[model samples]
Target: MKNEVKHVLGLSGGKDSSALALYMSQEHPDLDIEYFFTDTGEELEEVYEYLSMLEGFLGKPIRNLDPDRDFRFWLTQYNNFLPSAQTRWCTKNLKLKPFEKWIKDEYTSQGYTVYSYVAIRSDEDFREGLSSKNKSLVTKLPFKEVGVDRQGVFEILENSGLGLPKYYDWRSRSGCTFCFFQRKIEWVGLMERHPDAFEKAKSLEKSALEHGSPFSWSEGETLDELSRPERVEQIKRDHEKRLAAVARKRVVNPLRPDEGMVDLDEIYGQQKICLACHK
Candidate 1:
């Protein structure tokens, strides 16, 4: 007998993917899609909270695909170097590998075709990472198909009462609390909001440096260096300047001054962030 095709959507604990899930639920109720989150075991507390809220709305448990091996295990296997954009072993081993394993064993082994729904918005160009390797594993972008841009995504979340993740008020994007992709200001935000996590990142960086690793958690500085009073003041001042510049560039709608709140990519410039982790 031919196998049934399975529909799946991944939730990254970010606004875009969550909005995409809600949009799919409302717009395509007939499709029984399996929602999943690949937990890194190092994600923020707020990420779990947001996932719980999403589950409440979905009326189903978002499947958790945890790696058999944790971040530290992978770190050791990768020669103790911290994961950076140049060497993102964390996302590969912690995030993407687990998801691929789960789907391969659970769905593909049953000869089922998986149609994975991704949340690439209409305003954003489709990225190379969203592509699937297996012929049977098809990829879909509901937001792009429906013409839902960032504003539309915000509207969906607002109407759904999920709103944005709490970290957005300070930091932006979602992944591990100590994600190396964070801007220096975001590292400072982590230091202020979740000091323990910030300290853990510092310890990791220190160990990596002790082993002669080239990259710091953030560019051009270590977390300990970035957290010093004087350096913190400088980072804050630079962030304020950038925010003011972005705010000035905004043509006020006379209706939405709040729209001036800058995104991480906008302030720090876009990095090669993984959609599976940061979307």
Candidate 2:
């Protein structure tokens, strides 16, 4: 008997993943792909809005794979320690687990050869692709295969009228509102735009510190210290200096005003982006 096959793509509400969905739909219309978003329950409002916009273009509903337990519950499970780059319990529990569970129960266990699509762009290091232990579950990097780099992703979103997510104006990547991978400037952006979320992160960090957790949401200092008026100004100035440096390095296109746009990752130096969270 021929083995059954299933195609699935996960969206992180970031430009690359959203663009991949559009690319797949436009280029390979015959392949039925199941697009899903694994909700951490701490995602920004803009993420939902962007996902909705993507759905309209795809003419299909993207499945929301919400975890059985939310971020708070998982935080408690990890003894209230804030997830850090060194220890990322949040991504495992809040993002990957739910998607894995859904895939295992629905496809793999039923003997389906699952083709999981990931949005690792061509410009990025190929080592960033998410690997699976299951032999039947194959990871496919369509962007890398098709040579769709950062600029190509921008064009895809631009041509599709989906554009980038609204949060792109402030935050570079999309995931939990209080993602630890965020730059100091992005935390500042969060504070300026979503004060409540910033406060919640502060509260969580306070609790974590009180409970003997070493990690702060931001690397060097607590949110309280970071939020001080003078410190905020310092962060802004530093970010501006870095932004200027990056801008000076790039060759600008006069006709395309949007050319050479820089993201937090570009300014802050590239980070090991969370595939399940930031993509």
Candidate 3:
């Protein structure tokens, strides 16, 4: 018997991946794509809500590729060191490992060639993606191939009626609640929006630091320090200044001139985005 070919798209509950999925379904409806979300088990509640909303649009079950173990288990294994941007063990052990294991065991081992669809926009370089080392797994960038950039992604989501993730109103990026790539402003946003989740992140950071780990959740300061009323005020003010600076430099888009719009990437500059966590 000949091996089968499979198409899979990963959703991070972020704009890009969701837009890609909508684009693929509209443009390549003939392709039988399997959408999946690799659960970190630490994802924001809004992420799950958005994924559920996305499923309603796709008219397909978005498979949940959950890890066998949770973050606490992995944290213990790593001697309680929190995963930092420099060393994102969370992305590897928690996110990617579950995804890789799922496909390799459930599909590739059964002689299936997995074609993974990534959301690297036309403006984005192919430098960031889950480029598989497995001979059986291949990566595809539909957005880049079709010249779909950031603006195009926005349109796709808007027109699809799926819109952006709810958390985008608070935090632009999607991942675990305590993603180390978060900007100071976003940390303050988390503290304000989801106080409990914020507390959990602080607890994790405290444990990690107690174990003598050089890395805190965010660099330079502890979460406790960041959460201080004075420090939070400073961060908010600094963010407002950055946004004003961006606004001054902004060339107004005649098509959709929403001047108040402030992209996190525009303010802080895009980080080395995690493929598994950020899509």
Q: Work out the TM-score per prediction.
A: 0.95, 0.96, 0.96
lDDT of 1 by residue, 72-96 (tens): 9988997888888888888888888
The parts of candidate 2 lying over 4 Å away from their true place are 126-129, 253-258
Residue pairs clashing, model 3: none
What's each prediction's clash count? Answer: 0, 0, 0
Give the Cα error of residue 57 in candidate 2, in Å: 0.5
Error of 1 at 2 (Å): 2.9
Q: lDDT for model 3, on a 0 to 1 scale? A: 0.88
Model 2, TM vs. native? 0.96
Instruction: For residues 36-100, write the lDDT of model 2, one tens digit per residue.
Output: 99999999999999999999999999999989999999889989999998889988888878888
Model 3 agreement with the true structure over 33-136: per-residue lDDT tens digits: 99999888889999999999999999999999888899999999999988887777888888788888888988888899999999998988746546667789
